[model samples]
Target: MDLTGPQLCYNYTSNVIGPGELKTFKCPASIEGRFVRITKHTVASTALRLCEVIVEVNADTCTILDLALNKSATQSTTYDDGKDHAGDAWRSVDGNLDPNMPVGQSCSHTDQVGHQWWQVDLVRYYHITQVSIQNRDVVPHRLGNVSVEVSETNNFDIHSEFYDAKLCHYYEASDVPASTLLILPCSDNIVGRYIRISKFVPILYDVLSFCEVIVEGGDPSCIQGTTGITATTTVTENTTDEQTDTTDSPEITSTTISLPSTCPCSCRGSIEKYYNRSIESLLDELREELMVSKKETASYTRTLVSVDDGRTSSRNIGYVGIVLLVAVGLSIVVPDVVSLAMYMKGK
Candidate 1:
């Protein structure tokens, strides 16, 4: 296999994995590979086991759509001719479900050793639904306890690696043979471009093999659905003021009128102009009334002063007439009294 390719898509070193349990992994972009390998890295005596591997090609829903069909396949070690050969990896994804194929005709086989793996590349990113693997018709007992991983990169080195990938699914073997296809569906929307199937247990024969690996899902670009729409709105309002004159009670002057749209500011300008004209008219009327009131007050004050002066002059003329009458009476009475006294003394 291409050992110098990108980093691995998934890796597991835990020894607590039990039989019949499921595990999963995912990536963010596309991965390119042809083999998925497994290796025994833990201290447990359990053997590294794998029956099949699959890659999703559509959304997060498992269906008959296998995106890994006709894709390339590679392995860590291949068996010789007449034995389980390496080229059998492609036949699993070839969509031929003929379980009755002759030995080594429908499945790929690897040497019995540690750190063996198989990988496949899907070319581009896909919204993976689930991966399904079919166990070999012969010796299904060896296909137990395997680690499955998916990633956007091809770095197979599980140790000291950095990439965007995740374990979307995993499975622990049971005593019963995995004779039928084991379907490992992705839980969340796990997207990836590549898939890896590996074994990391130290069993008696640490050989990694599988009959078929089927990836079911679709391309990320062809997604179709509805989305939300956002919008914004603004509103403007105009107001009017009215003034009334109760003196003559003319038709109530109303400033409310239709605004003309000659420019953006024309409407507002017209309203302001009407208000200014009305205020100016009101001010002019008030000034005229104040002038008239001032004139009337001045005329009334002048008439009052003239009448008071005439009364004072008439009183002064009557006092002078009374004083002249009293002086005339006193002078005549004294002269008559003096003539009578002189006549009586002579007699």
Candidate 2:
């Protein structure tokens, strides 16, 4: 319930999010918590609104995997028709199944120019067993006649464009419906780093769109089976002392559970370090400017004090000049006869 204390497992500081933009943050390790809390730290006049927040946990088993989750994905061409929304390729493997393409902002779309395809790079070889796809709910027919192909190398050529990779499953026009989850299993021993859903045959005004794509499989080189540990619980009863006036006896219980060191990862894009660097640089610049301003202010103060001292010296000299002038005028008006006569006799 509290932001700090034992309940708090991790803290995340976010950067600016643009309008209609989705930002993702990935934790380095899986954190187990009862609730996920979000709080704003900036002082801005705008309101804080969250479109969605998704938390993904590890799959049940250690053998199977979601290999394509948040992996590198690309499309042939993004759908662009003077619209503010996007049909980016990364949306397919973003682990979001919201099929409403228009407002959901979770589906991937391609232009209706020619042959369209969306591909994900697994980064490593995996013996892919099955691929799950969710079609766009708005226009379900756009995902028909798609071929799920796998290849170790993604290099395409004139002859055998998919680099002669094996086809996992091909879906005809009537195979899948709108907003439906289709599970297509590949042939045995289909090992590759790239999985592509493509429509190769040229058709006029044909576009490709899908909500989500999940690639599940095991490591090609290593396949180690994992098991989970069961939790154990112990209960103890405390007896109340006769002298103490407590009526009920309290029960104390403790449980021991072992968590997996590593969990199935759906990696997300992180800007944590980027924000950290920006903030540090900003503080350093502010400190340097503050020091410069302090020096300039001190120098200006010294200059003002020096000017005042010069004015005071000039005023004192003026007073001495006025006194001499008054003495000479008085001697002219009424002469000092005794002192003058003495001075003349001495001369």
Candidate 3:
């Protein structure tokens, strides 16, 4: 171990400890060396106080998990202009490895041309060891000439590939089989907060589409000295035009995602901003609450039917309740459905 070298096992930046107060720092990864040295720099020479130091291996280092499942994802564009949101980018990390589209509705698609890309934010830096991707069952050749990259920053351009990133793997023409899951192992140094798959060279009907993406790794650490919370989140953006009829529209909650954890300091406000600004988030809340209300209403109706004395009255009440529920559901649902359409168009 180079004590005076630029590399470090860990950096401590917390406040000084008082008497009888113990401070612990955990290294992100295992650091194997012969000596464990502690150094403190001060402007002037001073007496040093000593306390017992303890070193233990982090159990999390041995536990490898999918770091990209249900995390925030974005792509160059939604396929077919978000007609039914069947080609949204969040589908790749939804833990569904189905390679079929429309039938399975499990894939992230982008517009034409090989200049498109899709990415997932891990919310923190991790030593990414492997990336598993599933190709679409139909026209699997469209997913050619792609590169899997990792970066610590989100400074990406839709039309450009200029960024501080490392190339982990590149798949040239027919590298991955059709309707198959391919797992590519990355280098040990392939550690970053963002894992992006980009295609630069154009081919026949070149488009970026994936059914699922799984990032496996462990030994995570905060990025940029900021402590961030990690959680399962999915953000959907509908670009469909507004329409008056809501009966034939697709369900907005088909791709379900839960709310994230409390405010994470290391998120850099991007995740929080997305949830607050996205109309889909509000629609999700409204739809979930509506479902809960519908269930409760049905339960109440069941209870009333069970306690009724007359069969005729019970049948009449049940029929009336069903009609009323449908009416009320339409009355509230139609307006929001229209609003969602308009919101998507506006965005």
lDDT: which candidate is best? 2
lDDT of 2 by residue, 86-118 (tens): 889998887777778777677888876567789
Task: Quantify how close model 3 is to the true structure by its C-alpha RMSD in Å.
Answer: 29.8
For candidate 3, report its TM-score. 0.45
Best by TM-score: 2
Q: Write the per-residue lDDT of candidate 3 for residues 136-225, one digit (tens) a residue.
A: 778886677788988889885665563777777887765467787777888654567899998863655567887888787765442223
**Which segments of model 2 are wrong by more than 4 Å?**
1-62, 222-347
Model 3: lDDT equals 0.70
Give stretches of model 3 more than 4 Å off.
1-62, 81-85, 201-204, 220-347
Q: Per-prediction count of colliding residue pairs?
A: 52, 0, 0
Residue 101 error, candidate 1, Å: 6.1
The ten-residue window of minimal lDDT in model 3 covers: 222-231
Ranking by lDDT: 2, 3, 1
Once fitted onto the true fold, the runs of candidate 1 whose alpha carbons sit more than 4 angstroms away are 1-64, 81-87, 100-104, 158-162, 175-178, 221-347
TM-score of candidate 1 to 2 decimals = 0.43
Which lDDT tens digits does candidate 1 get at residues 43-155?
A: 66877675434454333433436788779876666665664444355766666543433633666667756766677788886767678777766566555677666776676
Sorted on TM-score, highest at the top, how do the candidates line up? 2, 3, 1
